[model samples]
Target: MTQPNTLPQVQPSTTAIHAGYTPSGDYRPLTVPLYSSAAYEFGSHAEAVEKFALRASGFTYSRTGNPTVSVFEQRAAALEGGANAVATATGQAAVALSLLALTQGPKHIIASSQLYGGTVDLLTDSFNDFGIRITFVDPDQPAAWEAAIEEDTRAFFLESVTNPLSTLPDLPALAEVAHRHNIPVVVDNTLATPANFKPLAYGADIVVHSATKALAGHGQVLGGVVVDSGTFDFSDEARWPQIARARERYAGTSLLARYAGGAYSMLVRSKFLHDLGPTLPAANAHSIITGIETLPVRTAAAQSTLLLLANFLEAHPLVKAVHHPSRTTHRHHERAAKFFPRGTGSVLAVELHDADLVPAFIDNLKIIALAANIGDTRTMIAHPATMTHCRLTPSQLAEAGLNAGVLRISVGLEDPADLIRDLDRALAAAEVSGDKSTVKDVVFA
Candidate 1:
């Protein structure tokens, strides 16, 4: 088998389809075959020991590793220009495990104020229970991140393109601030997949994704991945003892010593996933691998449709505001243009004239499905105030630039004309219903 790293570097579109798999000899399958076995047999006891000691590269158990999942990992790592990758059962697990592995105890993390509600919950609720402290800072202000950093700060986290609002931060600037403090910048690239932006290329230390979204473009599987840029110096034993210091757990070998460039990803796989057991299934890995083959084309089409819809909505009298970086009215337009030249992505948020019109507007849409998930072949719309961002307090919502009058739309692989027509009808219906005092706030079942 040819290593993904050894394969000649190529364009992203070509790499998406042919990075990890290389069939040779008698069994030359055109596609990557699924290996569903829970365990693999070793040729001899010596070989088993060697594999267990990380001296050889082979899978022993599905919980820790699988051949099918490895292919997906390698492909993703190559696409992100990372040293390696680790796949998790869900995007939430990926976020949790990545942060958890970075710190052993009572550490601090500085995160962007405009992040996914689920991530906010994970940091403020779950990680708080574990004694980790998190401080939210406005991504627009690079100095805020610097001011919030302390000696115990382990990582700096932010979304590449913030959820719902489509806010694009100055990633390179924020990363520089974090790097100066010897902190790794962990970016959630779920919204802006590698097709549109590569966070690592812009100075980010780590990149993670909810592969459930754009990577698995059809929305059939749930998965996430963490990729390490292989540049962060983990040899600082005082700050990152897990990677730098020798431990008795794995034969007293430090990860940084064993895998010089891939310490972060290697530790995530061998320690975090090994103990936590949030393993990605072989079948799901195969499905995500297939979805990635068409990511560039799928994302491009949907992004184009999204820009058209955003423009149309902006022109409508009913829409109070449209929150997309592609719009000139957006504060982050220049930064977005510099980073995401392709498009801001398929997701955009629009604020209506009144909050009461949301339910009626969403219910009236015949073509767009009402769902929380994004990056699908079909269009999806959701009320962020009640759906994805409900966990946030009023002040937090305002800080994140989300409100009750705002609605998020994830454009899909549909014709712009048909989508525009459907949205036009829905908006008309909503306007009519908004005029009536008897209108209710209940969403359609």
Candidate 2:
């Protein structure tokens, strides 16, 4: 077999489909082969010893690695321009492992206030119980980010394109702040896949993706990956004492010292993944690999549909405002062009003129599914105020830019005219069902 190229030197469109694995056998299978083996037979006890001792590079356990999954990891790493990647059961696991590997008890983390609701709970409610404290900042305000950092802060977390509202943070500026403090910036690049954006290229130390989204464009697989650039200098004892202390646990070698370019990802696979076990199934890996092949084509089509949807909602009588990063009205429009120049992605938020009518409006939609999932081949819509962010307090939701009537939409590869017509029918019916007192609130200026 030819050695796989570790660097993301190929063009993204080509890399997405071909960077990871080469066809095997005389027939040259066009797709990666699914190696559904739990364990590999060793030549002898001596060969097994070397593999177990980390002295030789070879897979021993499916949990540790597999060929099919390796292809997915390598393909993701290449597309994101990272040195290496670790595939997980879901996007949430990817977030958990990145934080677990990067931090210890009593450590501090800084995150954006406007984030996926699941993330808010994971950081504020879950990790807090583990003795790790987190500070939520407005990513829109660069000063707030700087102010939130403390001496014990180990990582800075945020999304490239946020979930509820489509906001783009200034990745370079935020990364500079974290780097100056010797902290790693871990970005959730789920919304804007590598086709549109690569967080590592823009200065993120680690990039995590919900492969369940655009990477698995059809939404057929529930998976995620954490990619490491191997750029951060974790060996600087003055800067990263935890890394130095944890060396003995990872075969007596500091992760940063042993693996220069993909140290963090290696650590994640070897440590957290090996122990916690959110490993992806070989079958799921095969499904996602197939989904990745057409990512460029799917994303381009989705973006075009999203633009039409956003425009339609903006002009609709029942939509108060539309939130999309590319729109000049958005506070982060300039940042979006700089970071996600390919496009702002297919997800956007629409504020209803009347809060009470959103429920009826959603029920009336025929083509758009009422689902929380994003980046599917079929359009999905959700009311953030009630579904995704309901756990947050009113004040918290307000801070996160979520209004009571705000609705989120993930456009898909459907005919733009049909999507618009479905939405139009829903909005018209919603206007009639809404309370007369609240009718004015649902209409745009």
Candidate 3:
């Protein structure tokens, strides 16, 4: 038999720098060339017609795809072990497009109660307005997920490692339930980058990311990606009408029959993304590409710093709880060990004993910036109740396990000792201003 042709597999770092692009012709550029043109010129009207009809593969419009964004998509897909990917303007758009493509009004989705406040808002408000119902379930309870599934349930959504808390979901258990009912599992792998935790390997059918966080590894650019594993069968017209139903525009050929394995992703691009239009600018895409090159190194360094901070905070007097699985006392400690042996991606939530000290604690931080971002080279902090999750109602905050006193810290590549010192000084200042009765000498493990 003739040898099956396969590209030699490279490691994650190698794939990040080289997978999606190749230098060609004289004066070959070292990086992906930014094709800034709004539209690609076609040789003839026939060729343009063919491209527009989805029968041909070529960049006809920037709104649909771009060279720089295509490179980001390809590189992201390779990293996640996915077949195809689409990059969006923000991670929120990626999340919206992923679910919108799967189902529409009158269908149902079972989502984890432990989710970013923004996501909860989208599902609870916007999606509700669109007539799609969502059921929030406790991710740790496998039975709850199974029980919540309805006849019109189209998808199961959850984060690989939860925002702020770093709590892990039972992906295998959740996927089993969703797959048993022919529903897809969509995971937001933002907090835990693919370098540390690839949701696809844990039975996720589709993976989404907020590239502004860990994938970019820098706080400069804003982007998101939706990756399709291409393993799930969407051939059942009865379930996934968007992909499996034949359309008059495609000459009665269904998207699944035409694109085969890539049906779901093609529909995402051609349908929702094309119309809604959250295109990642080519320049921004180029910057995100640069960020991805050092993903492996950046992830490891930041994760190490995070673990150190988490340990120190867990032992502090003013801290009531540290919500990261790296700690032995954490509820999901064993789950972290099983799913994330490398490390949980570097974001943790600390609940202070005195919620009144939050403003002072935030004010005293010298090195850490009080910002709403994660997975960057510079460490930052976020207040869930007052910042990211401020829009959520009291009931919603309780569902996500966030409270007024919880502060989310994202560790960067800074020296662990310096970060620890900053934290100590901040806590000390807050303690002196708010409560002195329980203040004690600082200690770290």
All candidates' lDDT scores?
Answer: 0.89, 0.84, 0.87
Error of 1 at 348 (Å): 0.7
Q: Give the per-residue Cα lDDT of candidate 2 at 380.
A: 94
Cα RMSD, model 2: 3.1
Write the residue-wise lDDT of candidate 2 on 90-148 in tens digits: 99999999988887756899998988888888888889999899988888777788888
lDDT of 3 by residue, 1-445 (tens): 0111124697787887787887765767777877787888999999999999999987889898888788899889989999999999999999999999886756999999889888988999999999999999999998999999899999999999998688899999999988998999999999888888889999999999999998888889899999999999898888777788999867688998999889889988988778999988888898999999999889889888887898898899999999889888888899888999888788988999877788889889999999988888999998877778777777777777877678999989999999999999999998888743311221101
Off by over 4 Å in 3: 1-7, 435-445
Q: In candidate 2, which residue pairs get closer than 3 Å at backbone N, Cα or C atoms, i.e. clash?
A: 230-261, 353-441, 353-442, 354-442
Q: How big is the positional error of residue 383 in model 3, measured in Å on the Cα after superposition?
A: 0.9
**Candidate order (lDDT):** 1, 3, 2
* C-alpha TM-scores of all predictions: 0.96, 0.94, 0.95
TM-score ranking from best candidate downward:
1, 3, 2
Winner on lDDT between 1 and 2 is 1
Q: Which 10 consecutive residues of model 3 have the lowest summed lDDT?
A: 436-445
Q: Relative to the unseen true structure, what is the C-alpha lDDT of residue 109 in candidate 3, on a scale of 0 to 100? A: 92
> What is residue 149's positional error in candidate 3, in angstroms?
0.9
